[model samples]
Target: MPRWHPAILLALASLQLACTLLLLASEQGGRARRFLAALFTSEEDGPFDYSHPVDVYTNLSAGLESMGGKSMRDPVFLSPCPVVSPLLVGPISVQLSGPVNLSIISRRNPWVLLGGRHSPPRCRARHSCAVVIPHRNRELHLALLLYHLHPILQRQQLHYAIYIIQQAGNQTFNRAKLMNVGFKEAMRDEEWDCIFFHDVDLIPENDRNLYVCADGPKHMAAAMDKFGYKVLLAGMKISRPSIRLGRYKMIKHKHDAGNAANPNRFTMLAQTRRIWRLEGMNTLNYRRLSREQLPLYTNITVDIGPSEKAPARRLHG
Candidate 1:
């Protein structure tokens, strides 16, 4: 066998080490390339030549958009997780913990549905959903609902918006009317593919409960903690844009002030029922409210009862 010179053996080892480092640097993309370039080349060598295989691979792998096949822009990639799927999980325990601080949540979820709108950053969503919430007085409940909802909606990867159609005055908290108004307004604002009539007090316990609308109106809160883990049709209704529900929460409180249990509630319910039966969603006369026209209520409360009630009347054909 031929004996190798010491200098030749040392050179071979150095070359092997250099090749290994280059391999690692390629995997690390631009940062490692820049570091290696800086270490080996002087300022006189000018800026690092990024028109190399490593940089190209980095840009392509990151899903960056190339401007006219020239400069590269930030990536706009699709989410790794599937956007839509069948809900298979059972009910789970949900701890309200305490009132959700909107300020903190706002900072944390800057991309959450804001001013009643959000589009997914990934690929185009399967549906464009509009969440319509009737309002009178329920700040805490609303905050908590948004806190839990944003995360759930995000997990579902939906293209949705949140519309709080607040009542102008304290006249019987016309839930059905407000919901009608919300649907009309949301439709008027943009072409919504689906609409969800959601109660602010009902926080979903499981993320697996899909928020997408179905072929017909879908009752979401099939199993609610408030109803002893029983299905309640009163909480959420998922429907196509052509069909909508007049659903609202009966918030619990020390007094029946501005609640469904108020003295005028029965009368209001009767009137709303008639309107719904007669004109359907058209009974809601849409009116725009200025900021000053809207009333703000604080210290809202709620409670969930048993599910022994009869089935909800079908509001759509």
Candidate 2:
């Protein structure tokens, strides 16, 4: 051995002593105390990349050193090796406070975050409602509805999300089935108190009508512009004012597109019973027309199908 071997041994012992003293000082109640205790309890450890001899090989070593009162007294605890930052995770509230960014989970890590948070929907809330439209060859109608109805909904500020459930098929538009799918998907995936089993083509001209079925199953379209806005039926309005119609647009129907007998629509000409009552107007007075009744109505069905030039003539202003 070389003559300096004894000095090297002494230096190593001094370094160990310094590390011990430094770790003893960090016994205070905090992250240091917790980490130090955990270190003493663990048996195995992982390999680390240390820059210098003073740099601790493990968090346990660093923690013990941190407890020590004097950093210089114990170089190992005083000099910390960098550690990786752990993920900061928690659930987020989606009450529609403002704009939000939506990101899909990656294929590699598709484990849902608090997945399937939807609850069994109830008929409670009136304003914070959800409206659904099952789509097909109604592209033109969907655009019109979004252009006009979205602003109306935003104005209402109803904790709402507009869902356009497009059927993935090549057959005729399965409006009813699409609605059913939308209802299931929306309710199963989110916390919507109610829904609007809405139609794509039936775009309500007046935002006042808005597609909400809060009261009994409401037929929004009573006198649509399609039939020249003629009183095909009258006094057709939501039963319980603007706030109450059907719970979640519960007025669902079979997906038949026969124009003549399609009871699902809001013609009001024959199916006046389904047409919701507004301001307690009787069937007789409902058939009667008045200019003042426009605003009080909580629901107005849009004329989705091809229409006569009546509405155009009326809007000459």
Candidate 3:
């Protein structure tokens, strides 16, 4: 091989010198310092002294406390509603319930025990929430949903009430219209800070997922067990006070004939989005009745569903 060029050699020497200076500077602090210290320093130069009668027991105890126990800075735990913390657990399986099981649950947790339209007295919840369920011929599913949801909501320390807006008649199910009606009706009864449009088939698995609202619209059912713990856009839409990540079990059911491969599904969704942007909750032309003490389970029949008399084109409007 030909002799190496003198200029190249000088450049290489300069690079080495620069690298040495960088390594020296890296020893000052931060991650680079730690890495360089680990790489270059010997065991003798390390901070720990293995020979100096190491208080292994004391150190181990401290380490354990740091890892497993809460510190003084930690917030006080509220009964039924534990202090909110970052969610570390993943999606879990949930056992489904029938009407009989629900009736048993209802007996055990009567309107008085269930707090009716309010939360437990001991729970100083942060937000007053409304869980609106737009329903039609899904009583069994509704019962199951109520059985599981109340406990989770209570544990989350949310002052929440559940409303079941059932659609009457054999007309095509208008989910969006029912949702709008639920919002209006729930608001009429109580000054809910957060409104959750919940589907009757979905049940939350973890209580750590707080029911409190956020700054914007929140999609609660991100990771669902039905979709192999994948993020989904189904179930529960939060307005104003939105929400974040939460897992739920979506009970599978037979698709309605009206919803079977309905080509207008996307169009309806798009129209709703547009209408929400334009009018929001004010678009509906219903008179707000005076506030009433809504019971634990109250059914208000409204002409909110799609009308069979009206033309099919005006259904979305």
TM-score of each: 0.53, 0.33, 0.57
The global Cα lDDT (0 to 1) of model 2 is 0.37
Which stretches of model 3 miss by more than 4 angstroms? 1-93, 98-102, 110-116, 224-245, 258-263, 267-280, 285-295, 305-317
lDDT of 2 by residue, 1-317 (tens): 54668889899999998876677675553666556555664221211112221101123223323433222332233333222211101111111122222221111111111221111021112344556776654544554444434434422323355666654434344344445555555575467666776666554432234444454444565543233222323533343322111111112234444322433344433334443342121311111111111111112112222211111112445
Per-residue lDDT tens digits for candidate 3, residues 66-148, read 33332321223434333552222222235574443555655534322332454434434567788888888787787777766
Best by TM-score: 3
Top model number, lDDT: 3
Model 2: per-residue Cα lDDT at residue 153: 44
Q: After TM-score superposition, what is the CA distance of residue 234 in candidate 3 from its true location, in Å?
A: 20
Model 1, position 313, has a per-residue lDDT of 54
| Pairs of residues clashing in candidate 1 | 222-231, 252-302
Question: Could you give the candidate ranking by lDDT, starting with the highest?
Answer: 3, 1, 2
lDDT of 3 at 268: 49
lDDT of 1 by residue, 177-220 (tens): 56666776678767988777778778665445567767666666
> 39, model 3: CA deviation in Å?
24
